[model samples]
Target: MSQLLDVIVAEDNIVQSAYLARLIENLGYRALTVEDGKAALDLVQDSGAQILISDYQMPYLNGVELTQAIRDLDLDHYVHVILITGMDEDEIRSNALAAGADDFLPKGHNPTALKARLRAATRLVQHSKQLAEQHRILKEANDRINDDLNAAANAQRQLLPDIHTEVLGTQIASAFVPSAVVSGDMFGCFPLTDTLIGFYAVDVSGHGIHASLLSVAIGHLITPDFFARVVLKGQEQPAPANLARDLNARFSRSENDDYFTMFCGVLNSQTGRLDFCQAAYPSPVYIGPHGNAQTVGDGGFPIGMFPDLTYENDHMTFDKGGLLVLCSDAAHEAENTQNQAFGSERLEKVIKTSHRIETDGIPEKIVEALSVWRDRIPLEDDLTVVAFRRT
Candidate 1:
């Protein structure tokens, strides 16, 4: 149900105030009559009145003074002021208007003009109420969306591996930073056998909810059980290329162009034999114990894009005291206030010196270096890094 329209009549003349009040009540609005402008203002403030009909001459406060005072009040709704006067002077009308009078009524009190002004005031007040209601609804909806995004982000973080751990004699450390509340990057490291360990990094095609959904799905799909069934061959070493091939076949769709990049590696703990497949992911930096750094991997097709894509397996030796650093594209593409990219050269340089630092701290060191290069600005994309050191 709608609220009643309140019209406050402020006139010192008892006969005139009674007439105006009767007319207002006839128009189906509640009219409150007051003997002076001061009393009218009190009524307006108390009742949240949106229409004020005031006389030009009154005790304590006149019509113009009352209009200005009403305007000064920090009321939520707008008050439509109609100033009534007997004089025909232009200065009087101008003063009333300058003092915030929205309309004017002759002292003779014509019912037709009064009715028209009240109708207009009713329409305006109703419109304002509608707009306020709409703003409230939008705010509630936005709050709900933010809550859902935060919950999903927490779930995504749970899918990631620990920050630092040891698996199959290799010291492993990782870091992940999302550009938004949710991320499109995911990674994991797990022991495939008593002597073999597997690690992989994945970055979906874009940012926000769509990409984050796919990244989370990939995280669940690439578990150790899935690797055992699909990637590991009987009595032979696991082939990362086969995993890449399977992912490509599973996610590729003709309806949409969504896809992701991945870098998968299987390392033999005793021999330090590293077998890897890079699917359009950033080439990893291989740092020798003496700080010599070189990039690994030849570019291959991004997964979930093309069908029948052949992925090649690459091999390298993970010598003792050697450090292998893998990162998402955000590592090198992060830009400073000057818009200069941190670049692959800087990335290699940072990792090259990691041999001097503890293996568990290398991932954080890389992130800190990138933050400095970007001048502490938020990253434009998700940043992820996984580091492995042969002890």
Candidate 2:
């Protein structure tokens, strides 16, 4: 196809239309001449023609009428319309534009002015086409990412326990809510042996897919069988401190440098004694029969920071009728509409008020209180909470 024929010249006078066609050819574009606007519009529809050069007065449809018809045609490609007319009043130009003409030119075109206008029109057509292609590519990419996130979210949900359950001698209750499609927070409880129950919570360093994947990877790697592996190696079961250091050495990297903050604990079912380690995670809260909530452990460095860093284990007892709560940082960092951190203080208060509720309802109650304090504010981070009471 000749680049020149992308244009159609329409005029009621055959001589004028013929002259315009030749001028378009001289300008290096292929052109077609029609003696009226109606015929010119037909050519545009048939040829996917992009440019219309039509006189304001024609036997059938006039220039403005043709421009409006083209606009209403719903063609995939945009058409650029330039009206030619004897009138030069501002009102006429305004009406022509309102009628859908892209631009207007006085009849009997001067070579220099016509050349600049036509070239500019050509540039705009090309630019619009380019923008349309970019939009298409962007939509395709967005759809794929959304689909991937949906699948990842489902897999992440599968790695968690029921909303409430019992593990050995402890009544365990939990909640998990991701701020987005996937969460960086994870927690679990499993029987390490006939007398040992293991519990852990970790928040991988950030939100979304990368952090969620790392969090889930850690979850899968640590389990009841994991403790059994330590015994298979002919070594005593490691303390929570030893486990944290071991994980740090495995996950630490010089590039991208993925890491997490963690809390790990093992409960002796027979004695109701808890040995736990903290790695810069939020302190777990203890609520006993006295109806008060107190923090359990001192904070330490985050895991996977210094590969060889040593960790400290904290000791606590969860007698029957007592609640031990471990949560991701999101629990304390939740903000209210007043722009205040949900803070350790607020969490402690919530625990004390709800400690009298059933163990299974405690985490849910905290979530409900947080929802009210935010006053319609959306969660700004992934939220996870785990609590257990010796029965």
Candidate 3:
């Protein structure tokens, strides 16, 4: 950035050295002279000089040797070396270049040629320093972005419910595996009153920061507190179907193009009765005291698709000791090494075989099964699972 300010000259002959140093000073640069190659290296090392001009055939250490040694040192600046030799320019050209000289000069006190070479070296130094500064600025920006993403992921964790817990005689367990720093899939159930519990499992359409942000916004929008605030003034409580319709209306008014699929439900804590609506989500598997697991509910329109989409509610009895399983598409869509999908049939098979495990182990078993199928962790999409058993 600043002009090539400091230069060091190594010449064993005092007469030629003084003449050359005078010429450099006339070019508006500070120049210092050393009588040998060893002194040149030391001066350049300590002074942080960016330009070097040296004479060949010096005693103890030659000019070529000095050039190589200076280049090898790990310094904060880049050095440009010029080799001045008594031999013909063609004769010493190969060896001088091989030893790392950037340009070569013929031996003598020619003021015009000296001025031209030093001028070129000044431009080279300016360009190199500019590039180094740009690299430093870009690295700082990347580090700041990574720090912000990590902070967002930590805040998103608060939207999730406790992992393995039981309340109102119901055991609930969940597992969340995000492929990126944040996740687009969110699921949790909250109590609406002493006699009722509402739950939802949702997946936004796209992946990454925008999708993750919307999922968190949607989580708060549907919570019992927010839902209670938006419902009709006279209505003390709302059914699951009416709640789904309200979400459709609110999201339709939003300017975002992204949409989502969800399963919204309510349970009578005392009677094991579930009233739920499935909006373009997976048909949750019902595991009761039966011999085989049965899938429940049919698909309907997804949320935010239509302003007047009337949602349908289905009823099922989550009898005591019965379990319900819900998951995002990432589970079945995961691909094995052979490129085959671990589809719905495989997921159903795992539920039937492992449903008898302790209440807290159900979600863990599903995650393990998925890991084995994929042969590793970190699936390509956000993976989420929620399982609850009525006791």
Candidate 4:
């Protein structure tokens, strides 16, 4: 032991107490003599002693009663109680143990037995202290990790466009629900020119911190300046295929396995022309002016996988009073308790029913439908929906 262990001895006989105290000191421990069980408990409580040796008969409290009282105290350290008794009956031993006595010793000056018991008690107390210290450190580390995750989640939310926004006469509405504190999903709608509106919905390969980091990076990179410089070809309108190819080239690396699905588009508000590229993302639903729903986009390769893959551009029309919805796979692939998916048919039906409602309330209806399908179970993946309506 690095330091001396303090042991409390409670006995009414002054001679016996002195004898026990001398034996304790001789065994490389500090002895604290008390005349009664009450005094012994006070000494242990005040000194935070780890060992208590008490005679069965005392002035105020018996050894068994004292052990029970010590066990009830909310002290930070454990006190190993050893009852000294003259009787060797099984009933007495059972009663002492039942009252929280850790060990029992015959009422005599047997230094050998006392020394053995003290060594065992010291080992147990040390183990308990080590465990408490380790628990404190782990709790602090967990709290710090939670705080960082919350901060990152908040910053990612700030990158999202408002729930209801207008860009160049186009009414845009969006909804995002993350399964965890951080998400693998991101989307944005911004104007590229006075007559051109650019938008994108991205889902990183996996969920959690790594996926969220990539999504945030993509959100920061897909600005108007980026579209004018890289996505557009010298005074020409921005090409969706060029944006997909550039992202694939920038993110693909041999050292790491990271890829994402993207739906990138540039809509010409004046001509109602929508040029888009779908990189393995879910096909978007296009609702016509007469409320007829149809799907768009020919599925292409996922970005950031192969180094020299080519993506092609597809086109559609966003005419007056028509609605276009882009959703991540989570919205349709969500499962019920029976393990059945909320497939594309159900998703299209929900959008069709909400067509008469304002564009701002459409995404909420879709989210509510998914929530009811899951029966209140937590989402397994991130869910995101972006809708566009031409007035």
State every prediction's TM-score relative to the real structure: 0.82, 0.78, 0.78, 0.82
For model 2, residues 1-391, the per-residue Cα lDDT tens digits are 2344378888878788777777788888878778877898899899877888888888788788888888889888888999986655677677789988987778777766667778988888888878889988999999999999999898888888777999886899999989899999988788888888887889988888889989999888887687445422353543777678778878875456688999888888878888888998889889986766789898888887766788887777777788888778887888887788889888888888888889999988888888888885768889898879888
What TM-score does candidate 2 reach?
Answer: 0.78
RMSD of each: 3.7, 4.3, 4.2, 3.6
Candidate 1 global TM-score: 0.82
lDDT string for model 3 (1-391, tens) is: 3454898988989998888999999998889899999999999988888899999878777888887888788677789999897656565767778878898777776889889999999989888888889888998998998899999888888888998877677888998888888988888787777877778888887778888988888877776776444432354434566767888888877776878888878787898888888888888898886645888888878888668898887878888888888988888898999989999999988887767888688788999999998887568888888888888
- As a whole number from 0 to 100, the lDDT of residue 286 in candidate 1 is 94
Question: After aligning candidate 3 to the native by TM-score, how far in Å is the CA of 310 from where it should be?
Answer: 2.0
**Residue 102 shift from truth in candidate 1, angstroms:** 5.4
lDDT of each: 0.89, 0.82, 0.83, 0.89
The C-alpha local distance difference test score for the whole of candidate 4 amounts to: 0.89
lDDT of 1 at 36: 90
Q: Over all chains combined, what TM-score does candidate 3 have?
A: 0.78
Candidate 1 lDDT tens digits, 244-270: 999988998555988999999899999
Ranking by lDDT: 1, 4, 3, 2
Candidate 4, 1-391: lDDT as tens digits = 7899899999999999999999999999999999998898899889988889999889788888888889889677778898887765678778889988998888777989988888888888899889889989998999999999999999999999999999988999999999899999989888877888888899998888989999999988888778656666673655788888999999986458889999989999999999899999999999998999999887999999888899988888888899999989998899999999999999999999989999999998999999999998878889899889998
Pairs of colliding residues, candidate 4: none
What's the alpha carbon RMSD for model 1?
A: 3.7
